[model samples]
Target: MAAATFIEYSKGTQFVSTHIYGSWWFCMLWGALAIGTITYIIKMRMHSATLLLLHTSFIVILTGALITHLFAIKGLVHIRKGITTNQYIVNNGKEIKTLPFNIRLNNFNIIYNNGTSAPKDYISYITITDDKQSKDGYISINNIFTYNFVRLYQTSYDDDGNGTYLTINSDPYGIAISYTGYALLFFSLIWLLIDPNGSYRKLLKSPLLKKGMLCIMFLCGFSSVTQAASTLPDISANKFGKLDIMYNNRICPIQTFAIDFTEKLYGSSSYNDYSAEQVLTGFIFWNDEWKNEPIIKIKDNTLRKYFGLPKYISINQLFDKNLGGYILGPAVQEYYQGNHDKLHKAIIEIDDKVQLIMSLRHGEPFKIFPYGKGDNIIWYSPKAQVPKSMDTDKAMFVKNIFTLLNQSAHSGNYNQFNSLIAKIRIYQEQNGGNTLPSVTQVIAELTYNRIPFANILFMINITMGFITLLYSIYRLTSIKNNRHITKIISYTSIIIMLLSFIALTYCEILRWIISKNIPMANGYETMLLLAWFVMLFSLIFYHRFKILITFGFLMSGFFLLVSHIGQMDPQITPIMPVLSSPLLSIHVSIIMMSFALLSLTFICGLTALILYVTHRIKHDEKTIIDNQLSSLYLLSKILLYPAMSALGIGIFVGAIWANISWGQYWSWDPKEVWALITFMFYAIVLHKKSLPVFNSPLYYHIYTTVAFAMILMTYFGVNYFLGGMHSYA
Candidate 1:
């Protein structure tokens, strides 16, 4: 009944369900819905468009996720040097499949500008085919290839032609859900906006609206499905393979690998097909030339000929593991051609592309097999693209050429640093195989879209410190305040508001610059960049409503107070490759702008609290208090609406940017979680008019204080504790 049944993982961790669900998507969707609901219930008021966007996006995103989690196909293909002139190995996690069609690697090339010498970041290229059209794949960073619904990326490189390339794959199901979510969310926005002058009330109360809401609720239910879809699964197979070389007795997973060989035009692709290459016999040559490449007596003469000639498949030439198979692409062609052995070339795929080339050895022939290989499966040395000339016999170092294959690794692959073992194998009579390098070489290069967040503690702290200095000076100068002095003080407050705005702008610009070299590498930097943007824009409106300054002072002061109280993190410097991108500027900048924007509402609520705190002290107090409340009301009017409006705008913009870059409008990253929280914070403040108890200043201020806490969490707290992609800084 099941397409593929997986026995209960880890023996028995009980709970019964036949359909497999992915957590990455299912968990996130449900998480989004639950979080969204909680925010809606608490805030009480919301932008009809945002609610729609959030809901619709969730549905499509989850649907795509279901398709991905439920049924996604994955496999790998391999290419080898003269050995596998035929088919490439196709690797899948559970089973390795040998394809019928023979793929010949034509050539591989790395083209780069002559002017720049910066390790040619994007100059790699490769070509491979199914015996038909000349297909190609190229690699850069972040961008991979699109073949049908599957996108391919070059994951790694190796010298041995053994499988070592790594690739990132996306199941179309996730994208489908993502697209559906976007369609629904986007359409809902249009539906939300068509309301007439009285549309607000009508939209909120309509029966259709209620149904739409119900649909959203049902759509939200899909989160359970989505979470199961999005979760990353850890899989261990019976055989593992590298560079088309399989590890015996382990589950063979189809995988892709890359080769950034010692030379250019050498980047390529290779996969494992679980072939049985067993080493049948080994021979030791006593001649002094043995040092360079010991003589090997293969069991069968016919089998030995298929290996080409002593000149073509020489021992010394073929055995250098360090200078091994990392060579892929056109380099294989160039090497084979130069040596004058134009047989089948090695083919490999890098980036989303592939390359093919023929190769031959220039050194002496070392070992032979009886038409069969021993060590049925073993990691192979990336064969060296043998040169045109072989080292003379005088160069022999008395090294062991033939080795009996074994499980795990060759005699010296793992922790090769053991000198005692090296000494033991060094005995002249014993097979003293060369010391192979560590498996670390087998480790793939760590290149991701971005590391996703970190660093910048220094920047936030420095900015806070700078702003606090200005406030400290203003407070120090206030000795006696008559009405005239109050006017001057008001003007000073205006300056601070404007400066806060300026500071935010400056931070954004600096981040823009910083992100060019950092942050763009991952999702976290993008989020921080957005936060900064939100903070910057919020200031423009505050300048229009000067009353907001009273609250602004408290808000800014609170930030300063918290910084002083909390212990600072050490080394707020940039780290990780993904942290380097301009996207961080956009992501962090906007989010911070929202913080500055929504903060004013929190301040107004604070004023309301104070008003309630001393209500009985009214009458004359009303004059002074009126001064406060009047300022507060003017500020609230100017502040609350715009703050809410700006925050809403910032969030909307954020979602748009996220969709453009990541393809999904909203991910339940910590930043997203906070954005929802921040939106709801103001939503409650705006709708509180419906609640009598909250009408009192004290209650308002108390709620505002709580809201402020949420703001703090939305900005700083999430990063500090609740880790997510945007948690970087």
Candidate 2:
């Protein structure tokens, strides 16, 4: 697999590597090993029939794969609309292979999400014809059609929609056997999960697990909060709200609109000093103090130059004070509240008869007919498509905006503009034929508001957890007895983590309510979920295994801090079409859960390492620290199999989803490669106990800690550096 990955990366595309990997020797070696394992399990572990069946499936899969490699015919076929082809290029264009039947492309069209340009799906209408029979069918990324032991998979397309490309695979015998093996493997996994040997089944019986489950249930019980609507501010009243009208392929709330506009305009959704919500409301409502807030923080010198500013400027200085004139020229007057006595607005000077400057609101004003001269000029739609039928509404909207500007310019009283803005919004809403944005706006406000409840809870957990940890350490080291106080402090920190988890989970729920999509679609949301899962694991296993409460709080706090980064801002944006899969949600959630479990083990491993180092340095006999180290080591060992199992299942499930979405089960995409690496690394960690060198608790802790590097690569490294299909993060 490693060699195949290298070849794919260096050579580009997996065609050559696939042929090399499909070699007979490679297939037979794996098949032999699988067969040997199945035989050993059956003969030695007579009582473990389930285990035997599971091992036997591996041989079945290998045998099927070997057969497929030996006999399968695969190539790419590109058929232009209104054109038919029966031959496909094969072996890196070295030759062409003629199919048994002619393939005709009827039409190829891309499906986009409603109201947004994001592609929802790709489909190719096709017809298959032979001398004796003809069939009409279509193929999509996730949907395939099979005829006579041959399969057609939607693969790629030309820049324009005129041509459709598909992968044609003909494997007469091996696919059925492989599918049978896959079915058995899935059933075996399900059986193992429900059987007594399953870690989850045994853990479910523990009181701590029951308590954890109860807390989750109690936290999620009141779901009605998501249903309430109609409380958010008027959509039309907020210019920023109207600016970003589309989200998730539909018209979103004004709050979402406002944040998206600012996020793109300022290149940041929020700041440490001012939340995205505050900046949005402040800008929309035209609150003097809020507008004066230094929300538009500029770090780039080039941006500073672009804005015609010194090193930095506040939102008020740049926009509210009409300082935008320095950069935007005359059009700045439209956005300005008439704060300055003179306007240095820039003009477009079209034909020297008409001078115009664009407004930053939505870009390109409407061009009104009978173009008037000077400041009295009327602008109609830029696209020259303004409906003549609704002239009254258009006139009213323009009239209200002009009135508001006049009031700001002369009387310096902008309060009446609010009512005018509301009227304008109503007219705009009617024109656009959209539903009320109040529900989505309210949810966005709740989510992006300053120092959100989730953040506050995390802060409390971090502070309290640190204090408790310090106090507990003191009690452990000192001769004096302070057991009662330590116990109180420790439990308090645990309670704080519980509160944090609940708060974060509620935020996720609210997001689901408003966006109507699973919140695990992005890095920020996934990290938040990861933190919640970490807390869940700590709570469930803490009492039984003396899992470190302090570690949970610290790790959760760190995760929240990462989530708080401006780039990772939890802004509700539209998700890609490929992400709109039930399997995607399950894949990401499972991967996150596995990472969370591994993170807990990481904490244990680190604690054990620290104690081991301390004992070695002090040359002391076994004491409290030594006993604690042993407990942490035992806890890590106990968790190893569950974490490994989760990682394995998640990686495989993701492959299944990829097969559905990309038409190839294994793409060797960078993220997929790293995930496979992570799985293999964890597998080694889990089985290392069999080796004498790694049998010691010290070596086990060290290996577990070191193995976490692969997890980091799978999550962060693949996301930020080794970009690929999974680069949505």
Specify the highest-TM-score model's number.
2
The segments of candidate 2 whose C-alpha lies over 4 angstroms from its true place after superposition are 1-54, 64-70, 89-95, 107-110, 155-163, 171-175, 184-244, 247-250, 260-415, 434-446, 449-465, 468-479, 546-548, 623-626
Name the runs in model 1 displaced over 4 angstroms.
1-134, 154-177, 183-482, 496-539, 542-544, 553-584, 616-704
Residue 610 in candidate 1, Cα distance off native in Å = 3.0
Candidate 2, residue 98: lDDT: 94
TM-score of each: 0.44, 0.75
lDDT of 2 at 186: 62
Q: Report the backbone clash tally of model 2.
A: 11
Residue-level lDDT of model 1, residues 460-500, one tens digit each, is 42344344333432332333324454445555545544565
Error of 1 at 659 (Å): 8.0
The clash count of every prediction, one per candidate, is 141, 11
lDDT for model 1, on a 0 to 1 scale?
A: 0.37
- The ten-residue window of minimal lDDT in model 1 covers 274-283
